[model samples]
Target: MVSAVITAAGLNRRMREDLLSKGMTIEHKLIMDLKGKPVIIRTIENVLESGVKNCVVVLGHYSEEINSVLKDFPDERVKIIYNHDLDCELSETLLNGVKNIEYGLCLCVAADQPTVTYNTMAKLIENAINYENPENIVSILARKETGFLESAEGLGMPFVCHSKLLLNYLPEHKDNLNPILREMISNDVVFYGTPAINELELVNINRYNDYLYIKNKF
Candidate 1:
């Protein structure tokens, strides 16, 4: 079974400042409303609907508030882990979730990426399970720009990865996750990219404007 890990630990400094300055009381990007539901809630809902058997949600900065919302999920397989350091790097949560995942592969999904649909997730999981090579990293290429949904192959989230392989590289790793991922790619850990995806599915919420654009269009 391919499990899922939802990263929602970031303080979202940029989005927080922008919202506060604009006189909006939004606490975090994940808490912002998307089609009348919290972004994280929408993300979790879609993931669960995709039939992911196990899920781990990692929360930091606003753990209390976020935990309250997660209580709504009825799935017994969902696990919640708290990251003590609010200023900690993303790798911390990745490691924390890895310890709890009992599966071979993990879906490293982001809480702010609410547009990732059940269909996309299901396809990626199926691909990971049936992949010929155990060393290959499975992923979905989503929108990185306003381009064709058919041709755009921008590297993206909800990435299907070898849990143990990544966990092995966690020790001595520092700062952000990109460097380690790049290092793995350089070491020939090829990413098994899934089929083309809709540009909307890759709209990551980093800034207030990003939230606005997705809320308006999608």
Candidate 2:
């Protein structure tokens, strides 16, 4: 069964401070309302709707607040894990979720991306499962350019791969999976990209302005 690992443990240093300055009390971007649902909730629901067998969410920083909202979340497929290191990098948070998954294949998603669609998620999983190599990493690509999949910076989450690949390639110290993914691509590890149907689904909320942009657009 393919499971999903969503990283929601960000410190949100920039987003929190920016929103506070704007006189908004939102503690983190994950809790921000996007089209009537919280960002993280939307992300989780979208992943589940894509037909993953189960999901693991790694929480840190504002874990209590994050957990409070999810306390009554009825979905039995969603599991919550905690990372005590509030200052851990994004890669580490993702790794924490990866380590806890019980499935052979894993889909990596960012909780801040409320706009991500179930259609795009299902497409990514379909591509990964169709590939010959179980080790192949399948990611959603924003552009149709050929070289976009070659670099980690161009590779964003909502990607699918074997759980083993993440256990071996994810670096604990890096802010993101980009550096290690770049190294893996250089080593000829099979990394493929499926073109996103709507690029807006790939947009992530990082700062106050980003939240505003999403709210305004969607």
lDDT for each residue of candidate 1 in 1-218, tens digit (9 for 90 to 100): 77888888887889979988999887777877789888998999888887677889998988887777788778788899987667777888778887889858788888998888888888777766776775465454443422212221335467777787768776658567767666666666656555546767867899988998889887
Which parts of model 1 are misplaced by more than 4 Å? 142-156
TM-score of 1: 0.88
lDDT score for residue 207 of model 2:
92
In candidate 2, the residue pairs with backbone N, CA or C atoms under 3 Å apart (3 or more residues apart, or in different chains) clash, namely none
Residue 175 shift from truth in candidate 2, angstroms: 3.7
What TM-score, over all chains together, does every model reach? 0.88, 0.91
Candidate 2 overall Cα lDDT vs. reference?
A: 0.80
lDDT (Cα, tens digit) per residue for candidate 2, span 1-218:
79999999878889978978889776778887888888889999999998899999999988998998887889999999999687888888888898898758888899987777888788778877877886665555444443236555556676888888788777545667777677777877767776666657757899988888888987
